[model samples]
Target: MPYIASFDIGTTNAKGVLVTHEAKSILEKSVPITTIQTEHTAEQNPDQWLDAVLKITKEWLSVGIRAKDIAAITFSGQMQDCIPVTAEGEPVRPAILYSDARAGKQAERIKDELGTALIREKTGNHMDGTLTFPKIIWLQEQEPVTYEQTASFLISAKDYVIGKLTGRLVTDPTSAATTGVMNLEKRTWQTDWLERYGIAADKMPEICPADEVVGQVTEQAAKKTGFAPGTPVLCGIGDAGAATIGAGVSQQGEMYAYIGTTGWIAIPTKEVTYAGEGVFHLTHPEPGMHIAIAPLMNAGNAYKWAMSVFGTNTKMSDKFAFQEMEEQMQASDRRTSNLLFLPYLNGERCPVQNPDATACFIGIKATTKREEMCIAVLEGVAMGMKQVMELISDASDYKRITLIGGGSKSKVWNQIIADMLGLEVLVPEESQYLPSMGAAALGFINLGWDSDYQAFSQRLTAAQTFERYIPDPAMSEHYEHKYRRYIKLYPALEPLFETSLDSE
Candidate 1:
């Protein structure tokens, strides 16, 4: 039986899933990877991503999954990464992650030199430090040697891996859209914009559609990954695009929220409509559609931080802390507390684009304990998503939203989102695997096993096993009143995280 290998090179891990043509899972493997971080930098060794995938595939082979049994390979990976590479497909430097915002000045320069409206009109994004173009500029100005040695720049993690596999230099439209260089409508790079930014057009990879077979595994990649040398590889979409498709959001105006290391709320539309500067527009996996995503830089990571702070300090392992925190949050009474948390631990992108914003607990009393603070963190992230949902769609557009991600596994957080949105939140049993499932669906289409994204959606929806969290009427008013105040707190605090005195 032919199987599809789908991988998501995520911020926290490299996860791969093997699924049949009809999207039935065969085996799954994940390897945890490290991230290097500081005040203004977040980076990972792209070599780690390559290493992780190789290790996973070897494990899959050990389990009797033949190399030739894998019919096609596709990927869903982190977006907006600035990875400089040599001609030999080696990473020149650690990949600057999407959360890294060290290019604020460069972003401002682009917005200033080019008209704001012109940039927004063409790129469908407000020029910001979180994008790839400004980060490239930052590399040129700050680290001239790395910039000069770079043969090409790639936006998504999977693009780097694909280059190593097939020696192909190509990116999908979904990843290209995040660069703030592509003409969002045409799904092609703007050569003139690249020239204006002093980036060579040749350094940019060719933009390809998501479902196309852009490359085939080389003998070298086969040696490293234990895959058949000539196996076809599809140009898969980015992680958000995968989530959008996996959640069965095929119809227009259908919305879904994904909470991983980062989080986003997305709704598909027939036209590209400008909601705000923070909102992101991407070409949908299916052609001629757009997915407007309002993203949160801090979601599951905030929960991770809260556990580190409030959990047991006796050990560094999170397995114990998570179980203990889950019980405490569930056992505690959350009704009386008016405490609110701002989940901007790494700053925010959507709802507000302030990169220097900080997180804080408001309305905390001397009597407040760790349990209440933990509950506030969950509520705070949920509140942030509520702001994004309103931005991406009309109030009536999304009757219910499919929520998928690592955070979707949390029953407490899931219920909070349902209560906050006043809508049903469906968590598919395979929430953590949806992005990879979406990748598999694309692989199936390329293999001629499925007709279109809608067909895949219908097939998956009919067989999906999900846990539904219905909205709680008793807590809606409580959350609604708190949300009114949570929306106002950021504006009041923005001036505090302004331009650094030491930056100049």
Candidate 2:
């Protein structure tokens, strides 16, 4: 049987999964890469990504995986990371990662200059550092040399990989949507926004559908990666969109919640599901759909931070810490931590696009143990997620919620979210790696492993029972009071964060 290969280049690593055409997993592997950080920038070298991909592909092939039997290759990747390539398709500078916030002024300028309605009509997203258009403008203002000489702005990860495989310079619609360069409703690039932002439309790649075969593996790519030369390379979706697709939230009103380093609540919708304000929509990396998205800056990352401060020094291994933390959480108090945590470690997005927000721990008493503090930190992240969900609920009625990601692995965290939202959270089998798995499924669909998306999703996804944690009436009352305080704490602290930055 012909097999399919899919690559998911994530924020901190590159992962590849080789599977049968039927979406049965055959082999999976991951390689870690560096995300270089500075006071004002968070970046990854595009060359580093290419190197990781090359090494990973070669390693997979060395395991006796046949090159010729691979049917098609596709990708899913981190979005909003902007890397401008020279006319010859070489990196102009290190790619600005999704977490970078240096483009704040540019984002504000665009929103002020272009006005929100025009932007809303064009990109279907609000202007912010998280979007690529501001990053592009930032390039022009901050690095004039690189900006002037650049030929195309690539939305790193998938685009870079596709460039390597097919020698074709293009982007998938889903990825393009993240760049704030595509009209969500029209399914085409927003040329006027480019003109307004002083971006060169000529330099941008043509937007293509996620499942469309944009290019084929070259002789060079095949030789290095042990894949067959000329295998079709399909335009791939953004990681979040791909995860939602794989999670089977394709129809309107279907929702997904992911708690990773960052957390987000999304609903796949056909018409713009604008809830007046505070909710944003981006085109699903799929061809003709939009997904409402709101992100929490610190979700799993907040727990990791707490563990680092109070638990064993585990070198930031999420698995080891979670296993150790889970055991301790069961023995701890349910409602009384005497500690309150806010998971805004890296500022915040969605509902309140405040970059000046900071994490906080309040009401600590002498009786507060390290374990209690850790649990409190987890609770804080849950509350933060609840804030976003509440914002989403203001717009639409969300009934069922699918949970995915690293933090979702924790029973404690999962139950907290379920109780907070007062909804049953479903965790499908293989939920943790939904993004990459979605890419693999898309690879199969594009390769003709199945007829349509619905058929493919049904065959690929396996439903599993989730341990439900209904809200405790008393604890719910406690959180309701604490949540009101939590809401007020951030606004009070916002000015101080900005003041500190100014002092520095």
Q: 164-249 in candidate 2: lDDT tens per residue?
A: 78888888777777776678788777888788767878878878878889988889877776678889988887887787877777
Stretch of 10 with least lDDT, candidate 1: 312-321
Query: Compared with the true structure, what per-residue lDDT tens digits does model 1 show for residues 395-455?
Result: 6656788999999878888998999999899999878888988888888788889999999
- Best candidate, lDDT: 1
Clashes of each: 0, 1
TM-score against truth, every candidate: 0.97, 0.93
Candidate 2 off by > 4 Å: 276-278, 285-288, 314-319, 394-396, 463-474, 501-504
- List the global CA lDDT of all models: 0.88, 0.76
Scored by TM-score, the top model is: 1
Model 2: clashing residue pairs?
174-285
Question: Model 1 off-target regions past 4 Å?
Answer: 313-316, 499-504
- RMSD each, Å: 1.7, 2.4
